[model samples]
Target: MTSDFVDVQIANRWLTSCLSLFGRVFGEDSAHYKRLNEQFPSYPKWPNVEQAYGVLLAAIDDFEKEALFSIKQLIEAEVFDEFLDQAEQLHSSGYFQPAAVVAGSVLEDGLRKLCGQHNVTLPDRPKLDWMNSELAKVGAYNKLIQKKVTALADIRNNAAHGNWGEFTSEDVTAMIRDIRDFMCRYFA
Candidate 1:
């Protein structure tokens, strides 16, 4: 398994916590502990340590996927994907201005969702920059990300204000890619 989403220190703590809990139930030197160790051999050692951590993370991911599927069954949130899809279609059809507007809306919605997830309060009718600032205050992203988001918001403003000469199709393509990556990183 890959360590792309795994942190060693965090994994160590989780494994330690798991061992402690299991120990309390099964006793440290019991046959159950031995059998469990056999299944997940090498607690805090290299290779196996990361492998064990990956397994734990994978299980969590599986659980999250199931939960999201169940939640979707109960409530529809089709706007998120629809906005991105419309942006992509507009961009592909050479309607750069409309594409940028839709893409900007996607980014704005993403920021709002991020804020809601973190329980960060936001002003009514908050703009992209304001949402970005709130997210930064809560440490959702760093300075570099803020700067990039600022640039995207600027392009978005130009597009929304009918400043078509300010950006080209190429620019919109980059914006769409950036938003896609941002969504995958934070919302996927």
Candidate 2:
């Protein structure tokens, strides 16, 4: 009976670990995670636990075979692309200030992801300049990129604070282009 109890505890721990990892990597909304989540037993019966373990193993195998790169990175890339596309639309519609703000947001998010990928510690509410500096210190990028990010951040700040005269539509266009390139270089 003692051995059985220990086994159950171990199985539960394994299930919890697998669920956490899958949720973090593929996201909870992913089909792989959802399927395994469905297989997890509420009661922790031996057979149910075994079945869930099997499902977890199979999900890992599927993920390994299907994803050549990090799924998180791929997902981030897709999201950034969509946002950049929206920024482009905004620029086309003569809403350059909002476009700059959106493009700046994408840049900031890309920097945060890079910081995570590089294992750089971030504050609770990290600013773009701070993230950029941390990433540079960790050798994620060079001084040139850091300076470019600073300029982009300034433009973003201007747009966010209603400094319309500080930057031009052409500046916003260039900002979006630079952000797209930056994301492709890092997140892609």
Candidate 3:
């Protein structure tokens, strides 16, 4: 709730980001794979990728859940708990999609306010909107942004929903790893 707590919370979340980045690539299952010891020559190889990918998301989920929980606590302390209430009520009341939407929406709101406070104005939001006006900002005339945006859309769907259906363990690993890499190296 205090500035120090906010700083600590943000720093902790950033650490989670780092773990999430690696988890997506290596998987929590990877740890189990490394721990395996073959007892027989014909012992079947362990399956590491799917469970690992699950582990990866599970790690990210921890960081995300904790950060959001801390944020809610902060809001309560600040008496601005309405947003937290809204987030949870929707998330728990059979509005999963809406809950997810509000989470990011609140973040975007804070970003816009921060920009305003600093007298910084741009053509669009940074990460999310970068998919839209990026080409223009870079002085280009192509639809690269659109293509990337489409890829992101697919990635989001695949990462979130296709795990048990269309997405194999390897696919999930590759998807999360690629996304983390793209985010890290994108427009660098």
Candidate 4:
């Protein structure tokens, strides 16, 4: 499998989530009748477990395609240009820590926006790692890009923790450049 867009694990999880919701709506048994002697129905018409599972998988496959397509359109719509410009200016002004933070924010915000565009729910206060994991599960970026985003998150965390010794101005400059490229490549 190329794993270009559809992530099987994510799709499976999506199916599971849908099943859980359906279970709450229907009964866990998904039974429409209590017995053959019953005249009225206990539940509405419903697919059998196997049929429901298959239907959910097919529906999720289609939903994933729609999500990926919408994500591409969202990325093409120049969503983070201002953030990039600010990060670049801060990087050029010798504010390495601030620049790195801004750059990291750009990445985080971009990911959040991408998820929202695709109807993917995230945590109320999502950390960079969480955001990155969700995006990775959806196959938004390849593993290499996910790794790069991790490094960026580390840099941002260190700066936020007042541990500037871990990264220098040059490192922040590179981060700014990388973030700019990342935004351009994914969400221009």
Candidate 5:
């Protein structure tokens, strides 16, 4: 494999190792579990730590895939041999909104999975409650995590729906930063 591939392999190894640690410490109800998910004890469907670890790991997988393989490279590398023709056709009509939607969905899914895994009671509607409640659990959102997260999702939707008039690379970078910040602050 290429050096980038090697590096990602190493990163995956370390990340998975950390996940094992999460399972050992908070796999079930424990101090970490209570701290992360005890705001509402009545909810019976809280997520377990392994599931949260899965979310984080999946995000890591996403980060790795997107970072390492450009759409063009994916085609040129023949890594998408089966979809090569379709992808090549897409190059003529590439869409940026899908990227934003994917990123937003990753954050949302990861956050919810983490919350449920930790036995946190997450609301079924008016999404972003995890951002609110989880941050409340640790005062991390006091740094305005919710505001940033909401902004990220809003932009993501606009971009996804083609309503975004104009967005710059900086906007995408900021969204990525906020997503990473929240992950680092709470999930990791």
Candidate 6:
């Protein structure tokens, strides 16, 4: 009986770990995560536990064969492109300040994703400059890119804090272009 209890505990632990991994890799909204989540038994036991284990293994195999990393990068690229489009529209409509803010947000998010991809540990609420510095330290990019990101972060901060006169519409235009290129280079 003791051995059976231990087996159940081990199985439950492995299932929980696999669920967490699937959530992180495929996203919580993904079918891979949803399928496993739906199949996991509330009170794991006997054949139910074994079945869940089989499902977990199959999901892992499927994700591995699907080349999920490239798929994830492509998905991110599309989403970032949409945000960039919105920023460009705002700039053309004489809403350059908000445009700068939006572009800056994209840059920050890109940096965060790059950090994750490069295995850089992220803080709960990572600042743009901090992420930039960490990525540079890890040789993810050179100092030049890091400095550019620093400047971009400043523009974003200025826009966010209502410093309208600090930067111009032209600056926002350049910012949008730079962020688009950066996203394409890294995310695409």
Best by TM-score: 2
Instruction: Compute each candidate's TM-score over C-alphas.
Output: 0.59, 0.69, 0.27, 0.56, 0.41, 0.69
lDDT (tens digit, per residue) of candidate 3 on 1-188 = 22212234444454455455544544445442232211111222223222334554664575666743444434433332344357457646754444434433443343343334344454553654443344334433246634544454444444344333543334333433343333233211
lDDT of 6 by residue, 64-152 (tens): 78768786888889999999999999999999999999999999999999998899999899988899999999999999988888988
Q: Least lDDT summed over 10 consecutive residues: which range in candidate 6?
A: 1-10
- Which residue ranges in model 3 land beyond 4 Å of their true spot? 1-80, 124-188
| lDDT string, candidate 4, 67-183, tens digits | 445545554445466776787788787777887787787778877876775566987898889878778878888888899989988898888888989999888888877877887
Clashing pairs in 6: none
Clashing pairs in 5: 47-116, 47-117, 48-117
For candidate 5, report its TM-score: 0.41
lDDT of 4: 0.67
Positional deviation of residue 12's Cα in model 4 after best superposition, in angstroms: 54
Alpha-carbon deviation at 66 in model 2, angstroms: 12
Query: Which ranges in model 6 have alpha carbons more than 4 Å from their true place?
Result: 1-62
Q: Which should have the higher TM-score, number 3 or number 5?
A: 5
lDDT tens string, model 5, 61-135? 744676423433333234223232332333235544455555566566655655654566666563755455574
lDDT-better candidate, 3 vs 5: 5
CA RMSD for every model?
14.8, 6.1, 20.2, 15.7, 19.5, 6.5
Report, for every candidate in turn, its global Cα lDDT versus the true structure. 0.74, 0.86, 0.41, 0.67, 0.51, 0.86
Q: Is candidate 4 or candidate 6 better by TM-score?
A: 6
Candidate 1: tens digits of C-alpha lDDT, residues 1-188: 44444455765676777566546544577444454354453334455555555544554575566743434422223456677789989989889899999999888888888888778887888889999988888899998898889989988999999999999999999998898778777765
> Would you list the clashing residue pairs of candidate 4?
78-188
